[model samples]
Target: MIATNEKLLLDALPQPVISIGSNRHVTYANFAAQEFFGSSLNVLRRQHIVDVLPFGSPVISLVERCLDNSLSFNEYGIDLTPPTQIGGTNNGRMVDLHVTPTEHEEGNRQALIVVQPRSIANHIDRQLTHRGAARSVSAMSAMLAHEIKNPLSGIKGAAQLLEGDAGPDGVELTRLICSETERITGLVDQFEQFTETHADINSPVNVHAVLE
Candidate 1:
């Protein structure tokens, strides 16, 4: 049995971890591994490494090789699709694998496998960046509208005040000033749309219909 402190430390790690015993049995799994495999530690301990992963999986080979060679290694971009028996999805789960060979206090050879899932992590990062950029655009549009509209208002008022003092020749110049300010104001108001959000509508349609 794993000591309480050791188990706690393993559980605290964010990445999934599984320990394979010399007999190729799953000896231990951390909390992250439990969640990743969709099984409790007790359930996993009853199964062998091949039972957990597919037969002839790279992970199986890595663990066996680690035990045989007594060496640690890293493998990238391996897809260990969760077993169908568990509540895992059918989608490909790409992960970077790290295998470390070690001898414990009991003088037994053990292999540690830590799984770092890539696809989901990268997807979440991309989403966060996209949302952050959208928020920045909205804030910039709002700031620009505030700065431009205030000056435009002052200029429009000044033009109206000047219209009375001017003669016929200069009256048209005042009118042109007012009209140009109004046009620019309308353009600035259009920027307000960026601050508002609209729901996206999605539906599937036939490609042949579009081609026709």
Candidate 2:
């Protein structure tokens, strides 16, 4: 029988979670784990962790470490190749794994394993595209501003001179120049804001609070 707390923990985790006994056999797997491994809980419980996952996977190391040291082991960027279902092409998917000893009593121990994927290449591609877009927007904004500034100044000067010479009729043209310049300035300010660099502070925060 599974403990209530243990069941709640397994169900709450966002990523797939699996528990392995001292014998390296899967004792339990969360719903996410079932979906990811393409197997039901009953089928997975009957298999060994090593059999379901690739041999010598980083997850194996994590499991070994937790058992040996009786401590939690958290690893990042682990490449895990989940077992492919029959008749399915091997997608060669990789995942990150984390293992921690959940129970240890009278020399009988069990570990909780969490799985997450890290597609670094894909993330890099996305960042590069974002940078390219920012750069393009900056260049276009600068070019447009430069091209318009000189003509705008000339128009403002001419409007002012016309206002001085003509009667109230030319005052409207001067007002137009002022309004147009204000609009252009607002656009340039927006462009500058977009070009500014953003700083991300990396520190441990309460993940539960963030979720709430």
Question: Against the true structure, whose lDDT is highest?
Answer: 1
Model 1 regions lying over 4 Å from their true place? 85-90, 121-212
Residue ranges of candidate 2 with Cα displaced over 4 Å: 85-90, 104-107, 119-212
lDDT string, candidate 1, 46-89, tens digits:
99887889646788888888999998989987767666543445
In the predicted model 2, the residue pairs found to clash are 80-95, 96-116
Provide the clash count, candidate 1.
0
Provide the TM-score for each candidate, comma-separated.
0.54, 0.51
Question: What's the lDDT of the predicted structure labeled candidate 1?
Answer: 0.84
Model 1 lDDT at residue 150:
96
Local distance difference test values of all predictions, in order: 0.84, 0.74
Q: Write the per-residue lDDT of candidate 2 for residues 1-212, one digit (tens) a residue.
A: 35778778887877998888888888888888888788898998898878888767777777877876788877765645665543355344556677888764465788888888666796567569888998888777667766776677777677777777766756877778777876776676565454433234489999999999
